[model samples]
Target chain A: MRFLSKALVITWKDALSEMRTKEVLSSVVVFALLVIVIFNFAFGASQEKMLLVAPGILWVTFTFAGMLSINRAFIPEKEQGCLEGLMVCPISREAIYIGKMLGSLLFMLIVEAIALPIFTFLFNLPVLSLQLVVVTVLATLGFVAVGTLFSALAVNTKAREMVLPILFLPIVVPLIISAVKASELALSRESWATLASWLGIMGAFDVIFLVVSFLVFAFVIEE
Target chain B: MGKSYLRNILSAVSFLLMAASLYMVFVYVPTEATMGIVQRIFYLMVPVAWLSLLSFLIVFIGSILYLRKKQSRWDVLARSSAEIGIIFTTLTLITGSLWARPVWGVWWTWEPRLTATLVLWFIYLAYFLARSLAAEEHRGATFAAVVGILGFVDVPIIGLATTLWRGIHPGALIFQGGLAPSMLLTLMVSLAAFTALYSLLLLQRISMKNDEIEIKRLLGLTAERHNTGDR
Candidate 1:
């Protein structure tokens, strides 16, 4: 219980800071909207074609926008030297990792929530279904699981902005694949059995990477 | 003297094994019934692909040991393995493409195995990039090691996800009817030859890394002495 609260304190710190500036959230929201708009021009030729491609478009926007958000997760701490302050506090490194990961996850979920309605209205897809919501949440969890660790690693390197996507996107390819497939099935209102397997893959990905990233994040942030 | 002699013997053994495997693959193993002559590349390609995975495993193990021990030798091992692994992975993709063009009618397909290997390639490329872009040597090794562990752990998940995404039966083409005895023998020889070659290159690369680290140390020592002399 104490550990959970300590981790939540870090998450609350990030949220408090984010609420004050709204820098990461506001930029990602705008960037995601732009991606959807551009993708519409590029792929929106016909109504039928739009439906076929909608799930892929949605995930691609979220993936890249989520990259942008996660990339900023550690930069503020690194810039202001708050990381040192956090490190000296009475908490394990794993706690800090989970706290940061949840912050990014929450931020991404908010961006997705805001984008989904506009996307449905623009693309004419009923992507607001419960199944799609579950798919989005599960897939995004798997993504943020790995993304947070890589973000920490990237911020420590030179050319951090360039480093994050290269390190992040490849690792998250499986998540994107499973997510897109699951979303497609959900949008089509397919049988639960077919959709269940992709969800299983995403779930396995989330569990494995969450544990692995949690274990190794200390190495990345260790001075 | 002793180290060089052992390396020379290893090189010689690798050379002989490679020559014998080449002869077996080209002349001894009968032309496969279905794919015929093009199937010859499979002997070399499969072994190279196997070594590529083996090299990454070495990187993963070396990274873990480096973190635990904080030893430069383990870092050297991880770095050397990653450099060799990337080359072998590139060869795997190219040779796979060559075989696929002749057999699968396209130069590329989103086959599950092929896609997984491609993702593996990207992950290691990012590994190298991270290593190079790090501001300090120890930091680079530490960061790269983290990537090494994460990359290896993700490989199986990537494979599974790709397979599920496409709903394709894995390796349906390669092992359809299984291999003939002679072909299997040839494969065994080739795999042995490649493994020996991998060890030979790894030994050479590790020695080279050691020399490089030594030179850097000596240079730092001389610079420190020069500063003290000025004082």
Candidate 2:
């Protein structure tokens, strides 16, 4: 119970920091919007084609923006030596991982929420469905879970900025592939069964990676 | 070490087996009616692919061993195996592309096998990058080991992706029933040769790594002594 409160407090602290500065969210939003605009201009944004491609475009933007956001996740902690202080705290390392992951997830979700409505308006697609939201949230969960771990790993490297993507893209291929596929299927009004398999894959990947990352985070963060 | 001598013998056997396999591929095995001479390249390409995957598995196992034991020797072994695996993987891609040129009429396609190999290459490249960028000596080994294990998790996925998707690569051998007697024999000989070759390369690379570490250690000790003497 005490651990839960500490986790929540850490999460809140991260959120509060982001809100006060708005640095991560602003950069992510601008980057995502730019990606959408580039895709619109490059692909001509036809309604028919947009419907087919929007899910992928949305996710790609989210992924790139998420990468940018996560690269900064540990920076503030490292810069201020707060991670060391946190490491010396009584809180469990697992709790710290959870807290950081949740913070990242929340930030990413906020960006997605903002992007989705703009995407719908620009592309003239319906974006208010609960199903779409659920898919987005689940996929984002998988992304953030893996991203947080990689973010921590990359932070310690000399080339943290370059190292994150190199470390991330290959490991997360399964998640990205299944997420994009499932999102596309869902958007197409396909039967639930069609999307179920991919969703199951995404869930399994999330669970496996989450557990593995939790177990390994202790070693990774060790001095 | 006894293992080094064993590897030496394995190297000799690999050379002999490869020579025999080449003979069998060109002389004994009849050309396929449809693909003609180009089909024979499969004999080389398939075995190399098999060896590459096997080497990657060895790398993963070596990494786990390194992590568990935290021995520098295991780290050396893992790094050596990965380097050899990359070489074999590169050969597999090249031979595959050459075979595809005449058959598929294109140098490359996003075929499952091809894509998988590309991904595998990137994963290992990342592994090398992770190792190279690590500042601490032991940290490099630990980071490489972790990446090594995690990267291999994609191998089966790639295998499955090839099958599930409309891939131009031939269906996997295991699922397509047994090979013909002549083909099976040729493949067996090739596999044996390549496996031996892999062991040889692994041993050579590991020895090199050990020597490099020893040099570094000696240098560090010398520097320490000079500092103490100056003091």
Best lDDT goes to which candidate?
Answer: 1
CAPRI category for model 1: high
Which candidate has the highest DockQ of all?
Answer: 1
Tell me the docking grade of candidate 2.
medium
> On residues B48-155, what C-alpha lDDT tens digit does candidate 1 reach at each position?
889889999999999999988999899999989999999999999999899899999999988877888899999889889888888898999998898899899888
Per-candidate interface DockQ score:
0.84, 0.51
| lDDT for each residue of candidate 2 in B1-231, tens digit (9 for 90 to 100) | 897788778878888998999899999987777888998898888888887788788888888888788878888888888898888889989998998899999999777777778778877887788788877867777777777877776677545544344423345624345567898888788888877787788878887888898999999999999989875
User: Best candidate, TM-score-wise?
Assistant: 1
- Model 1 scores what on Cα lDDT? 0.89
Flag regions of model 1 displaced more than 4 Å.
Answer: B170-174, B223-231
Worst window of 10 by summed lDDT in candidate 1 chain B: B168-177
Scoring the B chain of model 1 against the true B chain gives a TM-score of 0.94
Error of 2 at B218 (Å): 2.8
> Can you give the lDDT of residue A149 in candidate 2?
78
TM-score per model over all chains: 0.95, 0.92
